[model samples]
Target: MEPVNDIAQLVVNGLMSGAILAVPAIAFSLIFAVLQVSNFSVAAHIALGAYAAYVVNTVLGLPIVAAVAIAFVAAGVVGVASDHLALKPLRRHGPITVAIASMALNLVLENMLRFGFGNTVQALNIPVYRDWVLGGLHIAPQQFYNFLIAAAVMVALFCLLAFTSIGKAMRAVADNPVLADIKGIDPEFISRLAVFIGMGLAGIGGVLIALDAAIEPTVGFRVILPIFAAAVLGGLGNVAGAVAGALLVGVAEELSLLVLPVAYRSAIGFFAIIIALLFFPRGILGKR
Candidate 1:
């Protein structure tokens, strides 16, 4: 491939990765917006999903798709469980209290995985689909599929939030939990649903990451920063912001390779978030 073609490929790959990150970024924003609490233990759920995929694929010899599906379901369960056990108890407290609880939950869950999985990196072996190259741009089937999947999912989410009563209730609760409750909305139920969607999306992100890279005990920790940065850059409670932010972060991270070491690519998200906040303050969309 020509140099220009290589750069194009890199850009495309970055966009694909960005879309994957957006999945969880949107989820994170949704939960935080609705519950007014940031679930720091979201990292744990990501790890759980990846590890679950590893187990099902490596141990049970299941297909990667099936394993990922199972992992998503499990992550949803864990999200609901965490809300019920760790977060619900602290709901009356300020958002800071829930954030702290999330941090604690993060530690507990990470330690548990370390104990059970032995602090090693596990690779998920998935068969590759055919790749297509056009006009010097290389398009891996999986990466293209990822982009399609993410885009479709985002569209579905938008439609759901726009047209569904539950979606309206969730948005109402997010805007004002107290008023929502008085208006007959169940804050607890909304919170649970938010958790379910957020963590499930996080799990999907994990599955994508695992598909692209090795699953390590520390993998979730490594990804949390970038994903969080994307969420913040997009706007704390805004789905559109999350998608935009994820793409921006992804492109920045990839293009940074021109002058900076590859290791610093991950830091682009933080820098971008800081800069975006410095300028927009309320975020790009000013949702919250």
Candidate 2:
């Protein structure tokens, strides 16, 4: 591959990774949209999902679909449970307080995993295939598969939000909680539902990541910045924005390798956040 093609390949790879990141970004956006709280525990849920899928796929010898399902359920259940135990009461304290509490919750959950699973890294039991070369670009089979899965999840979520009655109610609550209440929507129910789905999506994202990398306690933390960057860049609380931000950040991070070392790639998210706050403020695509 020529220099141009190398850059092209990086962009392609970035897009693939970005798609995976979008799942958690949307998760964050969903929780924030409905509850107005920054539930950073999405990171721990990501790790939990990866570990859950690991148990199903590696230990139980189940298939990928089954593992994915297990990941979603486990992470989601923990999400709702943890919220009920720790963050629910703090909700009334405001977004900053809830966000701080969530950060603490994140450490607690992460430490719990470390204690139970230890610091060892684990990987999913799956077949690896050779990469396909297209126009001098290398596309890995696993990555393409992950991208497809992510796309499918996003489509399903959009359909739910656009077509389903519960989805509509959820959107109503996000749009205007008081008006939604006046219309007989149960805010509390919607909040739990959002956290369940949001954290579940985070788990799925972790599973996809684990397919390509090792599953460790910090799996979610490793990419949390990009996920958060994508959410903030897209406009906090804006689902569509999160997806867009993820893709853009993914591409930018890939392209960054052209100049900087791989160790610095994570810093891209911080720069993105600073840039968004400096100019976009409310986010590039978020409401005014």
Best by lDDT: 2
Which pairs of residues have clashing backbones in candidate 2? Answer: none
The 10-residue segment with the lowest total lDDT in model 1: 1-10
lDDT digits (tens) for residues 1-288 of candidate 2: 489998999999999999999999999999999999889999999999999999999999999999999999999999999999999998778889999999999999999999989999899999999999988889999999999999999999999999999999999999999999999999999999999999999999989999999999999998899999999999999999999999999999999999999999988999999999999988889983
Reference-based TM-score of each model? 0.92, 0.98
Alpha-carbon error at 187 in model 2, in Å? 0.3
* Worst 10 contiguous positions by lDDT, candidate 2: 279-288
Candidate 1 error regions (>4 Å)? 1-6, 129-131
Which candidate leads the pack in TM-score? 2
Model 2, which residues run further than 4 Å from truth? none
